[model samples]
Target: MASRSKLNQICQFCRCTPRTELKKCHKCGSVSYCSHACQREDLTNHQRACRVAREGVIIPPLDFLKTRKEKERLTEILTHCVPRLLTALYNDLARWMEAKSSALLERCINDLKLRYTPSACETHVLRVVVSRDEMWPSSTSTPGELFTVTKFQVMDVQYARESMVLWKDCMRELEIQRREAKANGLGMIAVVGIECPALATVRLLQFTGVGRYLLVTPAESGQRSHRRARR
Candidate 1:
């Protein structure tokens, strides 16, 4: 057994002595981190090992997640499309979308503005709903007791373009709300959804204890998660 003085107590990420006790990796049990933040910062690298070891199935590296190349069309929408929509919320494009869908985008932006930083509201406020069925991804589509019984149809965007128009309107509307909010208090931002292949990485193996759940869809995988996703 190693002597107490000779024990390996260094943090894996910063390589500095942890202010508090270092926490061991729950999955691998071979590494330690100072905090969840350090573990998160090193996750991209860690996942390369952890995912495969945890899940027996080999996963290809995600190209989109790797390249993350700028979408030209998305940039085009920010530059030109949004302002046009703001001029008339009930214009031709709005006519194409269901009223509830448009309102949902606007409402989410408004709610986020209450929490998001001013700078984040300006930049991150423009978000697109990637999840199907609803903007917020849910695990089981089956109605829970908490699910509201409403007569209205839940809107899902079939094409990225369908969400884009409302996203644009919501983006511009947030700006307007921001200006008006300075006179009151609330201000913040999401409305940029784009079309890209839904590529993902596989990280499971029977040898490793990682694949606690199957990564079938965004709802089943990481989209709705908070802590698991931060890793």
Candidate 2:
């Protein structure tokens, strides 16, 4: 194994880090970044290498091709392809499962970070919500289209057993989601909650005498180019 000193002196892209906490690219284990900004700058190129040299290949399911809309396509890729790919790379993920609509889950998390600027306090429950627009493909879309929109309300916290193996299983899964670091470390199972589709903007909703939620409005662009930015 590379020593701590060795890790500190190497930079995967610029290769100028004489001594720093090597910011390892969570994907391909071979590359390390010197800083968060450095990693962000190298991400485009890193993904190419990661895809080619990473531990496993992810060929999307055949049904994915049949999905017409980009959102549906993305949904298929995240829900079907990603999990399968992670399972291939980490044997532990093969036995773990979390029921969620991929797009909504991602949208909610993005909305929280990009729009709401989440507080450091973890004691309060954060709600996620997404609404469908008239333009969005839905079950009522002309009778012959793929509309897979499901709403979810994921809690910021959820129940999970405590163990390195179990924590690892969750960590690997989150890493595959590209939201890996959110778990901070395998010290605890961090990403479990009420999975749901949320609004794009940060807003509050009153349900009864007193209740509110953070909504991620401005539905998905489906371009894949504007993926959630790193914090």
Q: What lDDT is reached at residue 70 by model 1?
A: 47
TM-score of each: 0.23, 0.22
| Candidate 1 lDDT, 1-231, residue by residue in tens | 867633557777887775577888898676788889999998877775775676653545453543344445554565577656434322322222332333334343344442233233334432222212232323344322112212222222233124544333434454565467556743222332321112111111011111222223434333544444366
State the lDDT of candidate 2 residue by residue for 1-231, as single tens digits.
Answer: 989777666776677865546766776677777788878887866665686568566434344455468657786777698667544422211111222333433444453442354341132223433233332223333321222233444333222213332233443444354334334542211132321132112222211111022233445434332563221
At residue 129, candidate 1 shows an lDDT of 25
Each candidate's lDDT (Cα)? 0.42, 0.41
Q: Which window of ten consecutive residues has the lowest lDDT sum in model 1?
A: 201-210
